[model samples]
Target: MTTETPTPLVDFTAAAAEARAIADAAGVVITAVDEVTAARRVNQLAERVWGPGVGTAVDLVTALAHAGGVALLAAQGTAGEPATDVGFALGFLGWSDGLHLHSHQVGVAPEHRSRGVGLALKLAQRAVCLEHGVRLMRWTFDPLLAPNAHFNLARLGASGTAFLPDFYGQMADSINAGDRSDRLEISWRLDRALPSKRPAAPQANESLVLEADSRGWPHPTGEPLGPGCAVEIPGNYSELRQLADPRAPAWRQAVGETLAGAFAAGLTVAEFRNSRYLLAAPHRP
Candidate 1:
């Protein structure tokens, strides 16, 4: 007879508790949206973030919520005052190899950014997924934005699995109106422990596949050199876009080609640090 170790149980209650603590510290209240009124509020908040005619319709949000999807709203208010909506996250159930949640969008009011409300909403979403036996979540985001790359890869401990150029084609939103919609598809394992701190910055000796020029534009330096390589991007891509800088499209093309090639060569984005994406080769067992 042989003794075997039992697998540890997923502590979903603890996850929910921590999410609640984060929301409390951020001074925001997160609630599930199940009714038409709440769904409409979510749509309104989306419009405020992305611009008019860019948000999902109220009927779709309502339908998704009623069909066992995850739709959450974040608000802030005092004891007697009515709560003002500040953020929303929407996702639907998906299945590939196994059940998972495909997070479609997460938006925060411009005035409410940098307050940890976004992170709180994500954690709350994670808790909801784990409770429903969904251990995996997937989403896509602009790969050239340093802050978004750091938020998803470093803050959430998610892994970028693919580089998709022009993933959504042209868009009319204020944020991405004139640019290609290149995206990094990432997967988050909800059962895994969240990162306690950001990853260490890339070392000075690391080879850079992409580097910024003196004019603050991206340029491809060389092919990825397996593990311990880095890809530097603009720290203020939004500013470049706002100025209609010609270099903005150059940055987009350079980053898309570099990441797409790197992924093709079997390298993965291990971490994002120092406004760079650090690459590593997958482990073989």
Candidate 2:
């Protein structure tokens, strides 16, 4: 009798096809774009996604692509046809903690958001990373953005480990303009299964270091009293900015200080529940 070998757990081709199907269902086609023309389109998409002064330049995209970086573009149209760029993800090799892909930026056009385009782009990124033997991807996002928090932590299974206040200083981008640019640094362990959003139930009398009041203003409620605690922020930063609310700065400071203090105490963001960050020390189970 001959011994049989079991199939490998990850099937890259199947995974890529599945991601393509997802984007296809949303009227978007995901493809690898390494050419100057395509890269230029992606550059334009970056501007649309991140706002002015935040988009990656065409030349930079070309250079990164030529340097063997990941240059994935999502387009609108049927397969095998010339399509217009609607989204892009750019990343490159890194040697900080072994060879990993430091996903610099991923952006979908404003008009194309909420259609699984971002998820498709990320799934494609995971497929590419697995193909190249890269098992980790790192990125940073504004912690105040609830949708991003949900997407990164709950949907994609990434782990938030650190908070960097004023990481990029003030920016001129329309989205981030006049903001302190605090970032939540997260890591995606590609080998793990992505988890669905299962936000933990909120308990009454839980120690909330920060929370929003009746008018959607973030206020400090308590200090870190145990290994675990919660920090809350308004779920809608864009709305506050659009309305030019005077409370935006207070929200930023309150949340920033709470997160900074918790992180400084060696706590990690375990989960986001009910717009509250479940922070726990590394020693906690």
The TM-score leader among the candidates is 1
lDDT for 197 in candidate 1 is: 88
* Per-residue C-alpha lDDT of model 2 across residues 1-285, encoded as one tens digit per residue: 999453234556766776777787878777777789888788789888877666788898999888889989988876687777788999999888568888988999988899898998988898898888888888899998999998888888777888999999988888888889999988877766666446566677668878788887776775754456888878888798889898888888888888788788888887776887788766321
Clashing residue pairs, backbone N/CA/C < 3 A, model 2: none
State the lDDT at 250 in candidate 2: 85
Q: TM-score of model 2 relative to the true fold?
A: 0.88
> What is the per-residue lDDT of model 1 for residues 81-119, given as tens digits with 9 covering 90 to 100?
999999999999888756889999999999999889999
What's the CA RMSD of model 2 in angstroms? 5.4
lDDT of 2 at 151: 85
Off by more than 4 A, model 1 = 1-10, 283-285
Point out where model 2 deviates above 4 Å. Answer: 1-14, 52-54, 79-81, 197-200, 203-206, 283-285
Candidate 2 positional error at 244, Å = 1.8
